[model samples]
Target: AQSVTQLDSQVPVFEEAPVELRCNYSSSVSVYLFWYVQYPNQGLQLLLKYLSGSTLVESINGFEAEFNKSQTSFHLRKPSVHISDTAEYFCAVSVNQAGTALIFGKGTTLSVSS
Candidate 1:
């Protein structure tokens, strides 16, 4: 079984400030990493993924994360956030094979104050 842990449940910051949301995971088998963002009252959308080849991945909206195999962590970060970036972020993992469902962390809500 695989499990994910998000260190922070909520993080508040002023607009245009930098932020980081920590994530760690453990799996008995090889897995793919993903970060998804959920806006208020909406379903999650994929932000980025670490499938293979690269340890670092980035989202279009200025967020990035690195897959650390030794530490079993995949932490998300953004250099400068915006009010529009306020949302809940989830770190997830899925086995490399089909028929395995994605498992998610509880989530970290990023509140950007203007």
Candidate 2:
């Protein structure tokens, strides 16, 4: 069975500080990884994804994640975070087959303070 693990349930960082939301997984078959974020009082949004081609992917808001095959991980990182970055982030996976459901991690809450 494949599963995604988000070790850190909460990450509190000051404004303009660096942050990394850890995400790891175990899978026997080829899969696609994604990071989803939900802002305050809003639905979940697709932050970034890794399906094929490059192992590393980035979002417009200066967030990036790398797909490490051997390590079986897709950790999201940002050099400097802003107060606006505070939100709930989730790591998700999907099988290549069409109409497949996505498996998501517990989710990590990022709290950015000024």
Candidate 3:
């Protein structure tokens, strides 16, 4: 079984500031890591993912995450945040096998203020 843990429930940062959302996961087998963002009253959208190949992956919106196998961590970071970045971010992990369900953490709310 795989489980995800988000260390912080809420992260408040001023606009243009850098922020990092800590996420850790535990699994007996290899897994895939992902970060999803949910806007107000909207469905979750994939921000970035670490499937294979590179240990580091990035999203189009300046968000990046690195997969650390030894530590079992995949922390999300943004060098510069905007007010529009305010939303709920979820860290999820799924087994590499097919038809596996994703196990998500509680979630971290990013509040970007001016």
Candidate 4:
């Protein structure tokens, strides 16, 4: 079985300020992890994914996440965030084996203000 947790339920920041949303996962077998973002009035979309090879992955919009196997963590970070960055961020994990389950965190709401 696998589980995901988003440490902070809400993160408020000013525009252009750096921010981070922490995520942690646990699984008995190999798994693939991803981050998804949900903008206000829009559905969720993929932000970044960690499949294999490098432990670091990034989104086109300046968001980045480093998968740390030792810590079982995949925390998302942005050096400079804009107001548009405000949204709900979700951390999800899927087991590699067939019929395995996909789990998602409760989600963290990031509120970026001007």
Q: How high is the lDDT of residue 91 in model 3?
A: 99
lDDT of 3: 0.97
Ranking by TM-score: 3, 2, 1, 4
CA lDDT of every candidate: 0.95, 0.96, 0.97, 0.94
Candidate 2: tens digits of C-alpha lDDT, residues 78-109: 99999999999999998877878899999999
Q: What is the lDDT of residue 66 in candidate 1?
A: 98
Over the stretch 18-113, how does candidate 4's per-residue lDDT look in tens digits?
999999999988899999999999998999999899998989999999999999999999999998899999999999767655699999999999
Compute each candidate's TM-score over C-alphas: 0.97, 0.98, 0.98, 0.95
Global CA lDDT computed for model 2: 0.96
C-alpha RMSD in Å of predicted model 2 compared with the true structure: 0.6
Model 3: which ten-residue window has the lowest total lDDT? 93-102
Query: Tens digit of lDDT per residue, candidate 3, span 53-88?
Result: 999999998999999999999999999999999999
Tens digits of per-residue lDDT, candidate 1, 59-93, equal: 88899999999999999999999999999999999
